[model samples]
Target chain A: MSNTLTPVLSGRADSPRLAWVLKRPELGVGGLAVVAMVVIGSINPAFWDAANLFSLLRANVITGILALGVMIVMLSGGIDVSFPAFAIAAMYLTIKGMIALGYDGVVLPFAVATMIGLLLGLINGLFVYGLRMIPLIVTLGTGTAVRGLLLGAVGSSQINIDRMPPALIGFGRLEFLRSVGGGNGLSTMVVLYAALAVMVHLMLRHTLIGRSIFALGGSEEAARRAGFNVRTTIFFIYGMAGALAGCTGLLHGSMIWVANPRDMVGIELDVIAAVVLGGTSIFGGRGSVMGTMLGVFTLVLLTNSLIIMHIDTTWQRIVTGSIVILAAAATSWRDRRIAA
Target chain B: MTATPARRMLALRPRRVDPALVQMAALAVVVFILMASLNPQRFLRPYVFDSITYMAPELGLLSIAMMLTMLSGGIDLSVIGLANLAGILAGLFFHATAGASGPDLRHAGAAVLCGGIGIAVTAGIVGGAINGLLITRARVTPILATIGSGQIFTGIALVLTGGPAIVGFPGAWSAIGNGRVLGVAAPLVIFIVIAGTIGGLLTRTPFGLSLKLIGTNTRAATFSGLRTGRTVLLSYILSGTLAATAGILLSARTNAAKSDYGISYLLQAVLIAVLGGTNPAGGRGSVWGVTLALFALMLLSSGLQLMRFSNFLVDFIWGAFLLLSIALNALRQRRR
Candidate 1:
């Protein structure tokens, strides 16, 4: 058995054909997601229903946005463990500021919220890139500070969006394909998610900044030697992530009708899980927006199915966590095989 | 008086006492001054020592676990989860055997002693094993793996209790958690013992040396045939065990267990570890430094509570301190 395996292993190592088959790791995750969907749908009839499917996509948007930010940071060879807290903080401050300023109108709130998010992200980037500190520790600190700021800003009362302007409420309530016979099939938020995904895909694959991010992730020193403004790029990446997280927070506020400091506490776990499950390497330098989208979808679908099945929320968390571990393990196995 | 080659080598080796320790000491001084200014009478009260002694044990255990993992160049974010789980498990074990209504005086003493130490140690070791398996054999990054496992562990705890607090443990168990020995809390004593033992292991044993080498340079460790994978695995296991033990102590003290029991400890553990001068990038840290950091943090927190500061203010201050520490560490490393 050893002799036979040795010949096969050596032959494969020498062959480009075998290498091509071995190199792609994301395919395994994609395949597992498909299998999981089929098996789950088969076991639970409601899993394939349109209403459940739409909610899965809708629920996934927030995670999708956060994961997108995480992907960029990871692509730049950094990790942001503070996004959940930052997202909640950004959301709280944006809504509070708007309310205090009496800019209850739609355009102003959106603009201000985005700007606030951008500013917050810039701080993260500055501390991480400019100060040359570890991204994890810096963001963790900033994340706590931001959460505290939100608590102080909002006090004990949660800002209820129900009293907001009708137009803002409509934006929150906006759904796509509702008039068509699909039973409120899609949402504007879902459309935004898709658009963002497309834009990110292009930026990562086509643009010079995207290439630079990939180069940085691949090797920071090499990229620096290659004339890439590594610090500037890092700042941009982290800032972009923060801005996106802020936008997601706004979306969350609109969707949930409240911006509480405690809401979404420790949610970075979910975002990171989605990124990892989508087959992105934690070591950074390689990822796909499409894969992340799928990852988000898988988690959302799983959660929805558990709810539909009336499984307890606690069990749901366990299942979701197990899935993340399984996904990570699968990715690692694939990487090892490729390396071997 | 020419410097010998040995002396030069010793000088070149990373300082036995990290410069971060100096910053921490400075931070401690600043904190003391701030506390004094805020409320001199309360700050000087002997009762504050009691508070520190009470909080030290669990914090110490948590800091040691965190320090061990950080030294091996990984972070275990799942300690809180593991601790919560262990606490719940201990509660259930006590409740089942001793009755859930009140203190089972007949069995309470043994249960408290055996259950507290036994369940804690087992949970700690097992949790560490899982982390080790995932990180080593499965080749998952420590942060992601631990975070995922943490969720799973917390979920299990939640499931066990149906998302409610598990209470009605024997009084004797509580006594051990709340009891003092030699003018200090038992928990503080436990912390000292564990920290001292682990510290000795980390600094004295071949295993400890290997861990430091692995954390500093994995490829170099591997090339030296140090079994880098096993070393990482062991560190993670040790971390898991320590976290679990902390959880048990927490449950015993509170006389109840909840899924959220260890949640608040997560950030605190990391903060204490780093504040104690453990490099975030892994390798080069000490139990002694972390122990001092634990006391400093406990003092600061207790001081804030006495001052009627809002939880938000406390959080903000802590976050500021964490950021400042990291920034200072970065600067010092750059200078080196």
Candidate 2:
């Protein structure tokens, strides 16, 4: 039974004094992450090497950013399988538009991309709020449509940015504490990931809108009865997700230095998986930003360690798929166990 | 409006004329007229119709498979994955036994056909069974379970085929893909027969009744003494098997099997099933509706191609149509 969604560590609170641990949703994931690092680090000290770790972080940070967005949507009881497509479209447009305008700057391209993403997310919000349609189907359709339209706009011809504004790539490349971890401390992308995580965490933990999101996810009818403006919250949540995705697309593109319209079409699954693996319930009402980050690291570490050992990336999907199943199974087991 | 005996009898008849079907049917007719007027030269040709007949069935089969799952109140996102995996297995079996350059190819042709089918069908049933067990025993929601299994199946397919499409089937393999039966494509014949059998199973069997009841309300069905778990299990397995049928036809038609073939169909098949009027919440659908929806979509798709619109535009239109239909349906339901 795949519904074993709540963290086993948190569930242990029923036995006593472990309630403190339950309050820290990210603890178990973080501990497991440390164990994973030590194991992988011992297996191959190269994994602890700065370059490999940085590369792993770089490989994961896209999903890391997107997972924060996914966590928001999931926490609100709606799903957006279309965010990758949405992000990809916004990224493609921004890159192409910037290249055409010969514009190159960190803020300008990112702002433009984020605004585009916001608009698209607003459309998703409108469908959920106005039409009263199922969020999953609505987003799936719109997401597909966006990708198709983007593909139509950009053919097989790959858009290369030879004159990429140094400021844009520099933002992604900027590293802090370069002397640490054998001269690989951290990149600006990691900084951005942390910044976003902190911002979202504060908003979720302290803000009224954040409380409403949790309430809405817990039960729409109950939220409505509690005087939460469910429609407005849904709009804001999906819109925020969209804007984040847009930023993700640009961040990913600039990091890679190419605007391949076809890439990341189905990458939302990875984002969703990472968030869920972090102990987020797929049916909503519970998840955390920090846990999601840990989840992202855990997945990336597994993948990076395997690739370090010369195992093919194809097996990564197998493990991820199995983890999703196991997580879901755990949730189901928990539900039944609690019921009993 | 006074009801006589005859009028009362008519009112009691099943299927009180659904407006959504009527609306869709009208849209189909209008689109046909528009296509004919814009591209009469190509649209009017028999060969154009032949191509539609050929291409529509594979997509149709996948849609119907989704429709079956939807009928039971769950969806099989893994259907396409299962279908492709089945095809890949059949392909691997054929490749191993009667490859083009094999010395025993002369005697192994029949083996290729038989073995190809035997392996493919078994793969479908097994995949479907796994889906069933995951949903019923594992207690995973259908979407998450299928998504996970879909990934696994796709990974296995990729690992087995090593990314490249496996080709080089026996010469007779062409008959199922390219050969004509009477006036229809062999693929069409296969599609129709399978659709009809599945349709009959859904309509004529007690299993169908139980599934519908289960979908409408699982607790109610259980209280009323139906094996809800078994019903869920059977429906998913059938959906998987149907996906396999599509996979086999795909291999036969393309003369190849790859991990990613018809990957796009995952979205489109869902589109078709929903467009065919299967309730997303489950319990109410008809194969006839799916068949009709298949015609509408295929017509739109073929028309767009006939006009030389890029394939991406076709994708756009399908997505737009799905959104529009759902919106309209919601509005209509609210009005009622």
Chain B: TM-scores of all predictions: 0.92, 0.92
Minimal lDDT window, size 10, model 1 chain B: B1-10
Model 2 C-alpha lDDT versus the unseen true structure:
0.80
Sequence-dependent TM-score of model 2: 0.93
- The alpha-carbon root-mean-square deviation between model 2 and the true structure, to one decimal in Å, is 4.1
The lDDT for every candidate, in the order shown, is: 0.78, 0.80
TM per candidate comes to: 0.93, 0.93
Candidate 1 chain A worst ten-residue window by lDDT: A1-10
**Interface root mean square deviation of every model, in Å?**
1.3, 1.3
Task: After the best TM-score superposition of candidate 2, give how far the Cα of residue A134 lies from its true spot, in angstroms.
Answer: 2.0
Give the per-residue lDDT digits (tens) of candidate 2, residues A20-130: 444444776677678878887787778877777777877777989999998999889788888988898888888777777888788888998999899999999988888
